[model samples]
Target: MKHLCRKVVAGIGIMAMCASMAACGGDTAADGVDDGSEMTVEVFDSLANYQGEQKGWFAKLVKDKFNITLNIVAPNVAGGGSTLFDTRSAAGNLGDIIIMGSGNGQAEDVVKAGLVADISEYIDDTEYLKQYQSAIDELTATANQESGVWGIPTSVSSLAPTESSEGVEPTFGPFVRWDYYKAIGYPEVGTLEDLLPVLKQMQDAAREAEGTDDIYALSLFKDWDGEAMQNGYQFPAFYGYAEGIGYVLSNAAGDDYQSLIDEDGQYVRALKFFNKAYQMGLVDPESTTQNYDTMYSKYKEGKVLFSFWPWLGQAAYNTTDHKEAGQGFMMLDIDDMTIASKGAQPNGTSTFIAIGANAKNKERLVKFVDWLYSPEGIQASGSQTNGAAGLQGLTWDVDEDGQPYLTDFGVKAVSGESVTVPDEYGGGDYTTGASQLNVSTVLNKDIDPNTGVAYNYQMWDSELAKRDTALDVDWQEHMGGARTTMEYLESNDKLAVIPGATYSAPDEDSKISAVRGQVKTSVVNACWQAVFTSSDAEFDQVWADAVANIESLGYDEVYQVDLANSKEMTAARQEVKEQYESQSQE
Candidate 1:
């Protein structure tokens, strides 16, 4: 331990010398220092909040440990983090610490521009980070060799324990109101063709039963669009396509790639289905204009009869009253396709953390980063506590058998019974900082010392036990156990294509990135217009025009690049799989 500490100090010295900005002249001590002086680091990611505002228990822990405050800068819909990143790079105002989501091009661009610190030499020196050398190597393998490792992986958790909820139904898929389905006689849904008709009948039944005129068969929001509207995620999965942020790989085509706008494409077919639904008045008109929050509000009121993601429906459905009333969202085995979340294969790493080359307090920041990857740090960062996922005494407690259990406040917060805590108590909500920790590498293997069960999955059975018969328990029993649906899907060979696990190479990103953006906008607009068209003739016209417009806007170029990249990515994934298999055998 002493030797490792010395190495950590030596590594920090090298980083300080390499830093482009002037050092703080030892305003704070180096590696082993624990002075309580406050240091603020700016962070840019989806988890960003207004500058210097601490939001959750994790943030509070970070402050207490390193005495560092994080000022997170999140992206808006008009211009995502990439746009903000560009502006900041040009102005030299990039955040002190930067985090890039998987497949994002900002990290590559900034690293190439010499804006990120190279922490390569420090990894082996740090006690905690050294354990993840393989993960770091895999993530950085495609990058510039001269630049060294410029980022640390975030959000990479090992597969849950076999006894845990590892391969249960994914959080994404077709979801429906269980009570409404049962009320309407559980119409046959063995095929995609049966789904819409069943939904239409259910919608009518719901309106009649509730005496409400505003119920919708399905609700959608426009906020989550990436390369295509959020529906892009749903439709492609049904078609057995492995989709990344901007590209799609079809299982039928083998290694071939096709964006949604291609000829005879799954996306185009999905649009036609939506068009029929819209014509049948099964879709909410506000879907095109409303945000996620609005859609969530409607979901809570049981106004949405169908949804694409389980979480959207599960949130409101998890409540005591909703469960007892049999009104929450439940999974379905709709015939047309087996819906699945984008495969969560270990991509090595998906998110990256790097400090700005121009950052101050370099030594302190390095130490803080090292501490975050430590075993103790993983628990401090990831687990849920009382009302928040935090430390034991404050947010949780250990049992006589050394099992960590949620405090009453934690149960209330996590179960969505009541998430808000008084400001006078902790001054932050329970949901804050859920993403602040990168537990991807730790969750699978790290058993909370106090909890015999893996901390991540320990709460699963307990949480289910708390739900009434109509909610989680009902859903669990309906599926014949947590893993039953997944096992069935696997046995039937009905799983969707698993996307490649690594981020795309810079060459691929440069070639297709911009065109991919243009194609997305064109596709989204075209899809909506195609859906809203009144007659079959009008639909054909609208669809053709949309396709033509997208093609003109560079759809073909993006598709070609995606095709080439897909083959390479798939091969890389195979290699990683083989390596892991070999390791297991050994």
Candidate 2:
């Protein structure tokens, strides 16, 4: 409800940049000073949903550590909520901080409109940010000519640690309920069809157990529709293509690109599979109407047996009861199912982070953001994920080997078994919650540069192994092969390619931006209609009609732009990868 943007004259901004050690305003601190002001920043990030109480543990932790309170804005698909940028632009009432979605040219658009501040000069003074100079360079090269570093890459592809050295385990692929599969004799599912009968059996068992006839074999949500039922985005991995819903380079040269709309394409096959599930009454009835929240709730209730992503399924059953009974969701190496992990791959763009041009707490907010990327910030925010090491002696403590090990109380806290008790546990909402600042950035390596101690994922696994002997094991004794779905895919060389990482020229963006809405609407409406067709003949007719409609709407023209962009992106990725490799060698 509060606006943090402060209107300042152009002369004042130029003067502030010219001054060496002066604070920008009375309230704003100099470059690295904790102003200790109680600023409520209206944060708009689409990727995260911060629903915690204002005085929750994580929120309080941030406030105490950074001297700022976060006023997280609710998510809105249409124009990013009530504080519309267009309206704010007119009224001069934009929020303090804004995070733009990656790859869609939102950053470029905002910068062109002269809304965000250019922090290029400030970034040079940041200790942690200096390491990402090359990444910043690449970003600037592709960004608007007028705006320099308007949005730093929250998800830095170039700054990611090498695969061997990285501790974060990428989660993507097919997941099934561990309890349900074991009950059904753990039948082999080498193909998509093989999953049907097993799911049917599982659904039937759920119905029988609960005395309810409303169980579903598979659940679906409609929010991800971005130019077709974006479920097609997840389908290509099943056929060995690593990329999701975009042009894939055909050869070693990255000169040629292919679209995913053929009659026999992965998208088509996926739709047909869903249709078959629907005809057999295995699909959730509310799929067309239900949102992600509803689907997730059902997942938590153990009503859905199959999950496309590991995160979705894992969240539902990752509790003390499920863990004690070994009944959580487990990923499987199904035949023909290729798992894809969108690891810290350098997309020339980022889910852009930019400070408002009129931000009152500009200096403090910038310092807070810079701290978020630093080792201290990353650890405090729980970027390590496997071990969210924060609040020493409560959530975790340093061991004799200088590694961070979760205390017994920390384990119970994370596992949702008991309250986390710190040495000085002053109570005000003692619930353990995730930090609101875990944005994508360069992950500082496992060994801390300052302390020369191992932390992050390396230490997390070590401590986990100490507690659970079978912790590292990804599969059950009944299942033979890679430990997790990601491992299986990596071993067999089956990872999906992310289209967003691909490059497109500035002109291409301007051209496609105008036509994207038209193309997406036509494709999604038609494809969804075809998916719900009753008979095989009707499905064929609908599919053909949809294809014809797309062609008539100039789909090929838009696709041509995508093809060129893919080729360019392919070459860009190669160049960036080589640069990183050369740096590592140096």
Going through the candidates in order, what is the number of backbone clashes in each? 15, 8
Q: Which ten residues in a row have the lowest lDDT in candidate 1?
A: 2-11
Candidate 1 per-residue lDDT over residues 257-325, each given as its tens digit:
666666477676677778788888998999889998998899888788887765577766446777776
- Each prediction's RMSD over C-alphas, in Å, is 6.9, 6.3
lDDT of 2 by residue, 328-350 (tens): 67765567764444434443245
Best by TM-score: 1
Q: Report the Cα lDDT for residue 390, model 1.
A: 49
Output the number of the lDDT-best candidate.
1
> Model 2: which residue pairs collide?
6-358, 154-440, 242-495, 242-496, 242-497, 243-496, 243-497, 503-569
Assess candidate 2 and give its TM-score to the true structure. Answer: 0.78
